[model samples]
Target: MFKGLGGLGDMTKMLSAAKEMQSKMAQLQEEMDNMTVTGEAGAGMVKATANAKGKVKALDIAPSIFSAQDKEVVEDLILAAISNAQDKAQAKAAEEMQKMAAEMGLPADMKLPF
Candidate 1:
């Protein structure tokens, strides 16, 4: 109740909104850490799992490609899978941010502090 304080009321409102946004962001970060995305390569022989925060959580490799001659190929597959997982994680995070922005009545193109 910043009555008669002119701009003080606006500043108080702004501070309250900023604080609410900060709290929402913290909650979103926690949710992103729990959400996961999976990427696969070599026809599903290699799979990588990562959180929406872009941290790799687990990797799965099929045993059929473990031969000596296929070592390089296996490595390539692993790299590809990891890259794909990271990409998906980024996209997922962006999508979630966009949803949050829309829910908060922000412009769709407004960039959030991620």
Candidate 2:
């Protein structure tokens, strides 16, 4: 054991922690990519599904809502559902980040680079 290399021990610990954090963040990113959330509008007649990254994965429209004269209404409902899904995705991402920070012993209020 090199007694003069005392500072190296601390540096090694810091490096290990940094590597661990990086690995956890990457895993979290992958999880978010596969995690899906759904939003609906018009009393669930219209539904939208999006991943935590806010990418729209699917949309569903009730056949009864299809009408030639109500085209604009259908369009609005679709937009509303998409917007709701995006908002929820954003919130869910934030929650996941916070959880990771907490587990890493960082301050809950600390913002993580995602």
Candidate 3:
């Protein structure tokens, strides 16, 4: 409605769009916290679940993998599962962000702050 304000109109429009995008981003962040991915290692002897935000939620280890002499092997499997879970979480987060950007009419490759 700033018809007579010249450039102010464009600035106002830009600010409004930015505000809307910020709101959408916040909502997406909340969604990511609830979204989860699972990763496994050592032929599924160890598994880790993490949220899209890269926070580990739960871990599962096969009882057969637990042994006194194989302690180090079990530890390695746990670490590998955790790392895989984190990697998947990061990829999922990026995919979600790209989808969001596309929905917002922005370039799919446009990176948004995580």
All-Cα superposition RMSD per candidate: 2.3, 2.0, 2.3
Q: What clash pairs does model 2 have? A: none
- Candidate 3 on 1-114: residue-level lDDT in tens? 767889887899999999989999999999999999998999998999999999999999999888899999999999999999999999999999999898889986689863
TM-score of every model versus the real structure = 0.93, 0.90, 0.93
Model 2 — which ten-residue stretch has the worst lDDT?
105-114
After superposing candidate 2 on the true structure, give the runs of residues whose Cα lies further than 4 Å from its correct spot.
1-5
Report the alpha-carbon TM-score of model 1 versus the true structure.
Answer: 0.93
- Candidate number that wins on TM-score, 1 or 2: 1
**CA lDDT, every model vs. true structure:** 0.93, 0.94, 0.93
38-112 per-residue lDDT for model 2 (tens digits): 989999999999999899999999999999999999999999999999999999999999999999998999887
Q: Which residues of candidate 1, in runs, are more than 4 Å off?
A: 1-4
Best-to-worst order by TM-score is 3, 1, 2
- Please provide, for model 1 over 1-114, each residue's C-alpha lDDT reduced to its tens digit, 9 standing for 90 to 100: 756789888899999988888999999999999999999999999999999988999999999889999999999999999999999999999999999888888899998874
